[model samples]
Target: GESVGLHLPTLSVQEGDNSIINCAYSNSASDYFIWYKQESGKGPQFIIDIRSNMDKRQGQRVTVLLNKTVKHLSLQIAATQPGDSAVYFCAETQGRAAGNKLTFGGGTRVLVKP
Candidate 1:
């Protein structure tokens, strides 16, 4: 399938270091937010998510922070590694959970140097 939007911006960091990827969304009505990671030539995979009711959420090695006030969101990766290198982006949805579709941000590419 064709890509829906433009390529992500890039962020480079060293291995074993912490990586912080940020995003600014435009929808204040969007109640649900998600962060995704996409490797080269592949589809996006989910990392973490937070609803409008929450400010922060965490996964195994990743953390997602949402600031509804400024319509900003961020992803923090602990101990960056080669495998963690990929394009990261934020997606948001509103209205009915079943009917809501995700709207993705431009994206940011994270390069982890060994």
Candidate 2:
């Protein structure tokens, strides 16, 4: 089984500032990683993703970075806003095959301050 965990339990970002969230995974075999944002009472929403072959990936004001050597993953949010406040999680999947389950991290709460 794979284990994922965030470096911090919470992150505070000033409005309009950038926020970086870090995560580490135990399984070196995991090839795919995803970053998800979960608002209060809502399910996780996909933010960005990166494959083991890629070092970095960007999507709409967000970036995902993968470091397979250290089994580390990170998500960056640009110009953090109040709406960006949520619990962020990093998930890893070992295979590309269908039905592969994602191993999610404990999650880090991002607080946006005005």
Candidate 3:
């Protein structure tokens, strides 16, 4: 499914140090990817993105690595902080009219230690 937003609400923990969330897309033609960080009670905010032509993209504290071969993506955040605590979402978009149009991945709730 393309451009699906938080159709469901949920939350959990970060455990000792790390956690991994997974997503499956229904479209095979989508060409770009983005990860967004939305704090509690706030709208989603952009974190990072990678195009179909690329396999990985990195940011200051985040990395968006894409596996076009499998239509898979993952984000890495270094030094998870309490401020980093939020609902994280990944999105994919096709490069055409309404190209800016986006479909978001199911979100993950991340908790940080004090």
Best by lDDT: 2
The sequence of per-residue lDDT tens digits that candidate 3 reaches over residues 1-114 is: 233335544444453444454555557888877888887566779887788888777788677777766778887776566677777888888885654889987777666766
Using lDDT as the measure, what is the rank order of every candidate, best first? 2, 1, 3
For model 2, how does the per-residue alpha-carbon lDDT over 13-88 read when each residue is reduced to its tens digit? 9999999999999888899999998877677898887889999999999998888888899998999999998889
lDDT of 3: 0.71
Clashing pairs in model 1?
Answer: none
Instruction: TM-score winner between 2 and 3, please give it.
Output: 2
Q: Please list the residue runs of candidate 3 whose C-alpha ends up more than 4 Å from where it truly belongs after superposition.
A: 1-21, 96-99
Q: What TM-score, computed on C-alpha atoms, does each candidate reach? A: 0.90, 0.90, 0.77
Checking candidate 2 for backbone clashes, the offending pairs are: none
Off by over 4 Å in 1: 1-7
Tell me the deviation in Å of residue 31 in model 3.
0.4
Model 3 clashing-pair count: 3
Residue 82 accuracy (lDDT) in model 2: 98
* Candidate 2 segments whose C-alpha is farther than 4 A from its true place: 1-8
lDDT, model 2: 0.88
